[model samples]
Target: MRLIKPVEITPAKLISSNVPETDYPAWLVSATYALGDRVLLDHTIYEALAAVAAGVKPGEEVVTPEAPAKWQNRGMDNRWRMFDDKVESLTTNPGTIEVRIRPGAVINSMALFNLQGKSVTITMIDPVEGEVYRKTLTLVDAGVTNWYDWFFEPIGKRTDVVVLDMPPYGSADIVLIIDAGAELAAIGHTVIGAVKRIGTALYGTSVGINDYSRKSTDEFGNTIVVQRSFSNRAEFDVTLDTSEVTRVRRLLAELRATPVVWIGEESYEATILFGFYKDFQIVFSGPTVSDCSITVEGVI
Candidate 1:
């Protein structure tokens, strides 16, 4: 089988720095600035680890959501999944941000295994104004399953999709969990065969030439050609068997040359299904060595 690449996210680059606090209410200004920076950082780290887990490059962009297309129609009855719900609250405590689901809205039978670790809590408080906000907590380790619960069913059977959202400028803490059963496959087991990043640009400038004839027109037409650039970063993981290594390498080369659409500026979460296999082989390379690693445990 070909090697599968994981999804990835880039580090958040600082967009703004030091500013005077006099522009707005002390609490509002502090909260906005702190939360904005935290959001960007958390997003960047999530993408990076997610991509590494999938065995893809570190800079690949992926949208963040609960599941893939196949799981959208499962019959869970729209229960309130803990991590799937978006939470918002205003308080003064920066210790922990918590939310309670109106118990029973979620079907316990449908729960699955927890895939990640302890949530990373980001607390933004305006000391002057006494306003505070929190967001989806970050996990310390990769592949920590302790933080979530999972549920599953047999193959060819349908599963329900949990609809979760986070309120703007609000705090959210999510735990990763899964539902497993006979015939139910862990969604992360499906391997990514290959992944690539691509971009294009204009090549050279045009030159002007004079025509000899009286009916001559200026010969200044531009010679435009397509120029391409590729990310130096790439990654791969071993699954299925060791012989699959060569095939995975070839797949990586192919992905490097594939064309990709430019989405401009956006944030996305991507999930990969690994289909019942545990042991995996991964490799990565790029202009800058990535701070990437794998987490096999259930808790971060």
Candidate 2:
């Protein structure tokens, strides 16, 4: 199986020196502002120049009709910095991937994405504190597919590991994408087995009367009969236009314990069939068409 490139997200800290408070009240659109009254707007700091009826937004360098440009920007060159902590390509190497965690860093949430769109078992080991967090993520698609499949929100955990490796718990298969609308011509490996009858049926029907009764006599020694309810089962025959007896037999065997869903038709609980009986019969009809009649039963 082919392992694709991995992506990771890491938290970044913002550092600033001699930073002033930008938490002043926002400048209203049509409010009177006095000179030297500071206001914050759009992540910029602005100050009023003269007593006017509007127009003083923090950090704006424009002189609009609503407010004359009387704003002063008090921000450093690099006050906020975002980190490039996406770890990719390292996951393709299995256990060779390692990530460093800074000391005294707070981690409230942690999420890992497995874009393979398949079920995988993983064992995560924190080598520093020797703590193990084990959990199985469901079917995860790739980044472009099901990107946000696995996550540990509000983990409230801390780790001091200098390096961490993510290896497979056992064996994992790489998931591949396939188009449901693709025709047989586009799919070179597509095999058109047969145009057989495919439908759903239930082994039994839902019951409403179960020990349902009403008192007819006031005598304490009166005898009563319990009502029994039964479920309606679905039964149909699938006739294939193929002469492959062995293939028909194998198909019948797989349908015995497999759940089948059939919808759209107006029947009693149309698509609620659980499975079919293991016993099946196949009859030869002519030289090509064969009759493989099987009972698709209800679950309940």
Top TM-score prediction, candidate number: 2
Positional deviation of residue 106's Cα in model 2 after best superposition, in angstroms: 39
Per-residue lDDT tens digits of candidate 1, residues 151-253? 3322222211211222222222122223222222222111111222211111221112222233323468645544332111112222223344345445444
How well does model 2 score by local distance difference test? Answer: 0.34
Weakest 10 consecutive residues, lDDT, candidate 2? 185-194
Give TM per candidate: 0.15, 0.25
**Per-residue lDDT over 1-300 for candidate 2, one digit per residue giving the tens place of the 0 to 100 score:** 000111222233112212233447766878877878766664344666666466534454566798556655543111111012111111221112112332122222122221222222333334453434444433322223233433523222110011113332222211112211222101111010112223222243222211334436546877675544323244445455555667657655655554333221222223222233435567777687666544444332
Q: Which regions in candidate 2 have their CA more than 4 angstroms from the true location?
A: 1-229, 262-272
Backbone N/Cα/C clashes per model:
72, 14
Error of 2 at 220 (Å): 14
lDDT of each: 0.23, 0.34
Overall local distance difference test of candidate 1: 0.23
